[model samples]
Target: MNRKTLVLSAVIGLLAPVLAGCGDSDGGSDGGDAIVVGTTDQYAATKDAPAPLDPAAAYDIGTWNILRQTVQTLMQIPRGGGAPVPEAASKCGFTDRENQSYRCTLREGLQFANGDPITAEDVKYSIQRTQDIKAASGVYALMGNVDALETNGDSEIIFHLKSSDATFPYKLSTPVAGIVSSKLYPKNKVRDGFEIDGSGPYTFKADVKDDTIVQATFTRNPNYKGDRNIQNDKVELRSFKDSDSMGKALDSADIDVMTRAMSPQQVQKMLRSPKDGIQLTELPGLEIRFLGFDTDAPAAKEKAVRQAVAYTIDRGDLISKVYDGMAEPLYSIIPSNVATHTNSFFNKYGDRDLAKAESTLSDASINTPVKLTLHYTSDHYGAGTQKEFETLRDQLNSSGLFDVSIKGEEWKNFRPNQIDGDYEVYGMGWFPDFPDPENYIVPFLDADNTLNSPYTNNTLRGQLIPQSRREADRSAATKTFGKIQDIVADDVPVLPLWQGKTYVASHDDIAGVEWAVNSSAELSLWELRRGSSAPAA
Candidate 1:
């Protein structure tokens, strides 16, 4: 069977979490075998379900996390951390010719939990559906370069692209390309509150109200002749409104696993106490917490002024004090452990050189004291963000060159205002779309940058990225992205502040631990196992 992969354009719509389920004891004469997972997000899912368990339409990371339990992608970077492996597809590789086209032959007998056979047509339908609804779908942006999706036969699908992109396969592995049932999805646009059909290891059993969700044991699909990474028989996910309550849930054993939002202070406390029946797992996260400047602001438009502000703020101090050692000092937009990341910004800025900042401002002759307003999100990121910003204000104000005022808003209004150029400066963070240089470069550097921060650099868009992706050799990809990073260091439209270090606390009963650096940095539900008996207490 010759497997072919193709790109399709489409928009994915995400609905809030509807009302959320399940039971089967893992061992003993009693019967409560399901592994219970808890999260701190206040999810609002719908009661009735829809067809087309499509990953494209779903946008929120939380929703995608749950969908992964029920749907399989072509490849997944194992949650336990390792190279990407085949999941739904049995054997997948690129064409030796042209280097642009790719193919993935499906494993024979792969069927949805609902018993529908998964075929190449399903993959084609999933890709084409996103293209069909591109205008309204936020996900269409990810598939901008997809040209055609051609299926060779029943088992094989071939993807032909406008250009050769090494990262294309990685994109296919994301939730955005999750296959949907062609027969179930409507030909027209899906409304906001629509339900979805899914084909993964587990099936949705009952849809309760705001109380909780219940799932049931997923009989192994005989057709599931795919990857062997998943090892769990069933899973139960319960949602909470915040981290404190979720922590209490874990304490009471209301849930067996808790990887919910934990405050830095709480994480520090957990790390200190080895006897808390909680284990903390830390991984390099593909997240960059940043301070963004509104380039339109008169003071911000000047390079020296921006450089001055960058210098006055101390990253190491912030990490030690504000983040409680939970974050790593960051100088590049791309996290340090990833490919193409360099300390170019650090080389230019030096170690909190306040004098250099003053000297830079002195050279710019920006004698006119410039007052700037800095905005931040109160709920998002961690709790110490406000103190971090206050420290920034103090440093800049003490320079006697800047007059600073700080304000904060909830995430809802904060995002729109930043997009609209509402404030002089603000804080933001990024979780990669996929773990590649293109993900770091394309979204923020492209001339048509989606964040709309006016970071239009033709050299980055027209030359740097294209030059990188066209290379047949993977090693050569770094040069182009490296140049883009250098440009970012010089331009300084957005100052990289710190790299997020992901921390998870789970009960000793939970085993088969796994995680990765990208946005979906959680234990893969399929691999989680509850101990046969109560943990040693």
Candidate 2:
């Protein structure tokens, strides 16, 4: 959820008003037949940000959650983890041994909700628009390997890559590559409002206020033709300002499902006593949180200073104190479940050694009590984040190895300044672009990485990442990934913190809660449906 905005959100100037839940729009959609879901996500538009729903412009998971209902990509990740399968396409694969060229044949007779035939040209146009608009927050960077997009007749499209990239099919599964009608969307700019033109499982419509979507409704698309089985006749996505409101909405049956931004305290409470008609499901998570440094900034420029901070702070404390023991300590940027994951950070620093931290600074001839400010986003992560950073500050300050101060800002201003290199150190959370170890390594270390930090590793970016991507069987890249993690630990550019577990709370009558989200962290609302009669509100 946070990862999508890491690159695109810097332009989001002011945090939009919190989600105003289904005030009165229920009308007739809240019967035993319809479903309502609540979330804490809000979209704000400034002079720089494109409309949040345009697939070409939106890089956010929340925005993509809404788009996935209406927009179809050429390929889609299945309900569970596995290789991506055809969604809009009839068949797709690399046509060459080098993995540099690929082709896809479109499903015949695929039509948009408005009844426009979706041709191969439309697929090329939708993807090319992302590159053409050139929004700073857009996923144009993900398509960096593409040399050209070619269309044949009306059913086939081909992508010619600049280099071998076996992960290209995984890229096609993301909504960033969502296909749209060529005629309705602008060729060089994002669509200006909350509207979608695609051939997915559902059709979307919404009411906007102050440039943010206030209410959204999705209905089964009558013209839809895809792999998914639509679960309900109608679904309403409501927005809440905080977890408290979202929790109350679930309790009162104002919303049937709650997800994405619940507080850790609330989750722990829910686990203890899940209330009378509510059930909580713990889905496997790939979400991770960590500290990223602006290596060019004076506060962390010196290697010894970064190393000292790493050695002084404790990651386990962040879980026990801040998260109420809800997350697992992350020893490397790559989560432990990933293949080739080693405790590089733990091996290098060895569990908060104060004497070692002090000696590293002293050995470099650097001054004691290093002054630095750690920055975090006020809204994006969750309610516990401010306390998380405060705990980090307390750990470093208590060690007497550094003078640490903390700064908190809402997602709007926080992202831009982080992008501009205004903060010395900042907090970030990531869900993978695809369910692969390479997604974790390349995004923060590469030139086109989403962080916008000045940290650089030519070997990892140019050689290691490319080498991993070229291996068609992902499991065989273990040695290369092993070397990459070691370098990340040695460089101390990004300090691994914790890996989070996903908690989705819903009414007891709701079905498909477990199947609604996949390992990639994409929310598939179409998988959800009303199993029994819900309370009449």
Most TM-score-accurate candidate = 2
TM-score of 1: 0.81
Give a tens-digit lDDT track for model 1, residues 1-537.
Answer: 011111111111100111111122232111156666766543343322221234655543555666666667777664433345677887677785555787888878777767898889898887777767752224555665678878877788888877767667667767767777867765455433324455666665535454333332333333344554455555667766556776777777777666645678777777665534555555545567788887877758888878888777788877777787667888787677666677878988866787888788888887735678889977555556688788777777876768999998865456557767777789887766665657766766664454567667778777777777776555567666667778888888888988766656566556543331123353366666665333221
Write down the lDDT that model 1 would get: 0.63
lDDT of 2 by residue, 289-345 (tens): 999998998879899998998898888777899887468889899887666678999
Off by over 4 Å in 2: 1-33, 532-537
| Candidate 1 RMSD to the real structure | 8.7
Clashes of each: 40, 1
Alpha-carbon lDDT of model 2: 0.78
> After TM-score superposition, what is the CA distance of residue 210 in candidate 1 from its true location, in Å?
7.7
lDDT of all predictions: 0.63, 0.78
